[model samples]
Target: MKKSFNGNNVEICAPAGSWESLSAAIRASADSVYFGVEKLNMRARASENFTAGDMAKISRICRKSGVKPYLALNTIIYDSDIPEMKRICDSAKSAGISAIIASDIAAIEYASSINMPVHLSVQANVSNIEAVRFFAKFADVIILARELSLGQISGIVRAIEKEKIIGPSGKPVRIELFAHGALCVSISGKCYMSLAAYDTSANRGDCYQPCRRRYIVKDEETGFEMAIDNQYVMSPKDLCTIRILDKILDAGVSVLKIEGRGRAPDYVSSVTGAYKKAAGLWNKGRFSISAAKKLEVGLESVFNRGFWHGGYYLGDKAGEWSGISGSAATLKKIHIGEILNYFHKAGIAEINLSAGGLETGDEILITGHTTGARKMKIGSLRIEGKSAVRALKGQVATFPTDFKTRKNDKVYLLVPSS
Candidate 1:
């Protein structure tokens, strides 16, 4: 998908929190990022929220990286707090913010007071043709609610095109969509189920993910109980439509969003890398991207709950499931040193991991983070720079195998689940 937005380039907009995640998003080729500050973002409970000052620094980083930085001012505010809210928005505006998300009607007024561009958040739940048209009246862009089908999105686009809603510069409003990550069980993300039950609010950026928690349903007739949470009845696995990203770009969707506010840095890197490659391969009419092997290989080491679906890209049949419990296993343990110059070279044949859990010798795959594949075997063994009888953890060992591994290739010791 082309990252061109109108006359400008369109790029992936990934979620970021800490410096590591921000760096990862940029390294993976994301064009922009959205995150919460200490007060306004939805993930307040997350460890890596930007302070008021931190956000200014982050703005600098974004400019240096040539990426845009957008702030989420999405929480509902009362009438009494407009003054303080204006101050925050003004500070963000001074930092060269691309946009600020607003859910309340007053958000438009507040944004105009500070002369900041406003994007209507999906929390507004502007469904149907008329609702989208209404939202476009105030927003420079709109993040469409995630419940729409491709046909529905097409319809929404037609509505906007017909109305000619003003864009950031009064050209035409941009329409962004969520292409990847966890989906809300609720339609408009207005569920009070979490706040009412756990005292945590999904609004104002502090969702405790009570959906991931277990629950018991009461039976009115028999008064019996039914387990809910562990079964993951409400918690759907993350949505990953990276393979069909082109279909979305063609839809004229302004931004391809990845949903992960509290995710690991490496996770951001892997997911961003996959989408980056896919988007690059996407041409307006010519389709010659055959990097299926590359995409699969790249996704192996990233943290995922398993079960990647086409999401709304193939229509609503793409209902998501719960995330896998063992997504952290992607990082494997491998032999310490398989090659003397593995760090410098690329295409090495076979590489050997430490014999920690191996019986005598076992065939394995050497998956490099950036280098792709370097499969090899183990015959001779050296521990602490000397020939060793067996491999053990905490022992320095060098065994010859296949792939020319460099310092960049993280060696994961593979052991499949039983």
Candidate 2:
């Protein structure tokens, strides 16, 4: 959708893992991002979740780039987990997070009292106008549940606009949705499979995701058995709204989200990049969602369960999760090096190599938190106070660092450049 839906603004929020994916989100087109820490995140165990220290740094990077960072407090809070959720909200405020995605009412209440903006998380199951408005009384935005239809969202967005209670300064409390990524066939993210099968509670941020596992329904009648398909009975295909970006963007909503904080770096990078490009075009008034077919390849480069569907955008269809799953993906770029400094004066990419690695004329690539990369040959690289003619064994010598890389970044070097 164009930045305007009949003159209204549209924004996009993506998922992030480490500083790399967070920066990638900004570089790509994410108007904002949502990530989780170990406490209240469902995917805390799956993705490279962020730490408090990392948020202190990454939040600054996001602010500088005009990209918002959201702290996910979306997990259902059991009786014992309330204190931890409080800590998460308090810490997020200290780190300057743009907002917090909340599901529990107490979590919402606590977050509302804080200075930060509250985006009602999907776990709240806020699918209607009144529910959205009720949360709007506290939340700055309402994230629709994954099980919502297009019609349901459209109605809620209209109600949100009707509310006179504006945001901190005088803006209407906006609406948000899960425009993409894996879907759970559970109710409002309250899955019992984890608790029932493995005694793991999804609300406690310890889900085993038994729903994604394969299952066979056997007939109880005289022990009759029938095998229809493979596992992943409840594993719905990922939500790919790239095809329906315009509808989502123009839905009078403030942010369209891609759901994957616990995903891999490749997934975070590629999916975030594709949506970033799309949103960039939309913001620039060159509206194109479906027209950006060329960008779709980036999404496939990462780990996906295949079977793309607009879920709820199209009429009801079966096998959303009944398809045979795809295989794992192995992408280039493994974690190999670290950033020492950025010698912008010499315009060289300075990086520190571990072990007896650097050889004369070897090329290394340096990627910064905010910068993609800067490539230069080892033949022309330099070490501290002297040319790195041969980087010594077990010593940390600075190599051509022209990419303006800062310390504390995970630099990746593609050896032999395959």
Candidate 3:
């Protein structure tokens, strides 16, 4: 049955939080990236958003690395925020942003006025053909709501094909889908809990993540309230679509978006690289259960908030909406070395290599009480002030560090989850 499927022209889109994550995405072979400029994007509150002056640099870097950069302006806009929004839109146009992911009608109109391409954000709640037809007038692409099933997505694709909505390039409009990442407890990420809790609207990019907090369930009529104990009733499991890549592609989605702008570089590289390989396998008509499991292990190793599920892709099953009873962290790291000495002035830390060897481009995770868990790659490795590619098992290796480390901070080599 898989032999009948085709995966040609499918694009893998990743998230970029900073230059480190951006470079990691490119190295992992992501075809494109979606990022925020400042506080205008939904993930801006949790991410280190770029400044306006960094727009041109972002465009140049992505283009040079053979990747496309899409500016995300998906937050709601108020009347008082019009001028600044217009300025950002104008800067996006000048920076050659591939497309603007927007939810506001004003943003759509601004993109149209500036002759910039637009993509309808999922925040638009586009579930039916009517909504698609309406947004088709302003957007070249419409990201479907996350609540749709595979059959429903196929139906929407068929319906749009009949509408004859041409894209900005005069071709048929494209459909993009969220293939992986965190799932929202609310209906398509339109939640009011944050506003109710702290008067900060999530749609306005000031969310406080009230959903991840502990809560007590209560019955008003009986006046009874009790704690669930170790369970987050409102937290949904992260989404993983590796097992259903063929089905999604068969539904006519040309772009697959991986959601994570607030994650570490290792997370970006691991997830994006796994999907890139998975999509390639599907295109070759060789996708199998073992291949999917391998990809799943890689995903679990980097991060798994509550675990993974098919999410809405599995449809309205009885337990599809239930939350998890605690998060699970997998993927044990291999002990490599321990901190020996530090040259704080030079931003370098010396490690007494013991177990595993160190090589350039190898990712290392440093952990301590004060240092926490910081992940970085070996951009430069030295042995006694001389450049070295691979530090042997007993050699003292020196690598650059960004944060202050304690005397006994441990270093571990990160690998795919076993």
lDDT of 1 by residue, 51-103 (tens): 66676788888888888888877777776757767777888887778788878
lDDT of 2 at 387: 62
* Count of backbone clashes, every candidate in sequence: 29, 14, 0
After superposition, which runs of candidate 1 have C-alpha atoms over 4 Å from their true positions?
1-8, 79-83, 216-230, 284-297, 317-319, 323-418
Q: What's the CA error at residue 235 for candidate 3, in Å?
A: 0.4
Q: Which candidate number maximizes TM-score?
A: 3
For each candidate in the order shown, give its overall lDDT on alpha carbons: 0.66, 0.68, 0.80
Return the TM-score for each candidate structure: 0.75, 0.78, 0.80
Tell me which of candidates 1 and 3 scores higher on lDDT.
3
TM-score of 1: 0.75
Query: Could you tell me the lDDT of residue 163 within candidate 1?
Result: 68
Please tell me which predicted candidate would have the highest lDDT against the true structure: 3
**Candidate 3 structure, TM-score to reference:** 0.80
lDDT by residue (tens digit), candidate 3, 6-84: 2237789999877657776887889999999888898878788898788898899889978999999999898888898
